[model samples]
Target: MGIEYVSVDAEYPMCCPVILCDICNKQLTREGVALRMESSTPQEPKRSPLYFAHRGGCYSTISATLEDLYGSGWLELSDNLKDFMTQLAHNFNTPLEHEYTQYKLT
Candidate 1:
């Protein structure tokens, strides 16, 4: 078989406003939040150095990736997944300690 290109859905549901959260996959009907990761250093990795994550998915799906990366709690997710995400951030020179980062529900 030949390589097939995937297409993104351009249509939006009418009943409810679909929103994807950058952090914590919590959909919001009203205005939500957004987070953007950018690396402007002299030395950067291949691919993209800038990443945008928006809460309450408004015509965007990048936020979905953030959700899958970081789950409900730090222990809830796998070390490999966290490492992968952190490594991506590190590729952009992110000064975050993967092991130090915690996601606990109170």
Candidate 2:
């Protein structure tokens, strides 16, 4: 599915609006990612409900979902998807050398 940036607000079972991780089922308190499925129609693209998850482990669950939907080489099909995955991976799993720098900044 193609990616589109959109603002979201969620309020249902909870009194206060909160986004929960689709994998872990916990409230997301910091950086997270949203994945949505887009319909084939370009004129009237119907998007599925957003799948929200934390950027590190939870976000990696999308890889299995994507592979199941689009086969194993899903990332190879689109550079945009690959870049997005790369950034998410880097967010929580930084290299040892960069860890100190990242911790300092954050």
Candidate 3:
């Protein structure tokens, strides 16, 4: 199979990481870089939503962090409010990152 690469400009309140290829949804990590890619480059219209609008990456980190607690001492919390705050803290991180990314991009 051939590879393809597309760039996304997701800005904040919607900030997110620089996803290298929109087609395959590849992320650019601190660990490595995407060196080469090949594909039948689709003609991304200049008026595409990705071109005209500013968007942020999907927020996933908070859910993931809260999920982590289900397996740990966080399960010991008896108050529902405490649990809710913890969940909220976890969820907010991704959106916060999105904002940070937006600021940097602009």
Question: Which has the greatest lDDT?
Answer: 2
RMSD from true fold, candidate 2: 15.8
lDDT (Cα) of model 3 = 0.28
Looking at model 3, which ten-residue stretch has the lowest summed lDDT?
45-54
Task: State each model's CA lDDT, in order.
Answer: 0.35, 0.51, 0.28
Better of 1 and 2 by TM-score: 2
lDDT of 1 by residue, 4-97 (tens): 2323345743343333333444442334332333223425441222232333343145545544764321111222233434565677886643
Q: Global CA lDDT of candidate 2, please?
A: 0.51
Pick by TM-score: 1 or 3, better one: 1
Candidate 3: the clashing residue pairs are 3-38, 12-15, 12-102, 14-56, 15-98, 62-90, 62-91
Error of 2 at 32 (Å): 0.9
What are the per-residue Cα lDDT tens digits for candidate 2 across 1-106? Answer: 2233323546443355455666887665546666654344445533244466667787788667765765443222222234445665797687544322111110
TM-score for each predicted model, relative to the true structure? 0.21, 0.44, 0.16
Model 3: CA > 4 A from native: 1-12, 21-23, 36-106
* Clashing residue pairs for model 1: 19-56, 19-57, 20-56, 20-57, 21-55, 21-56
lDDT of 3 at 12: 25
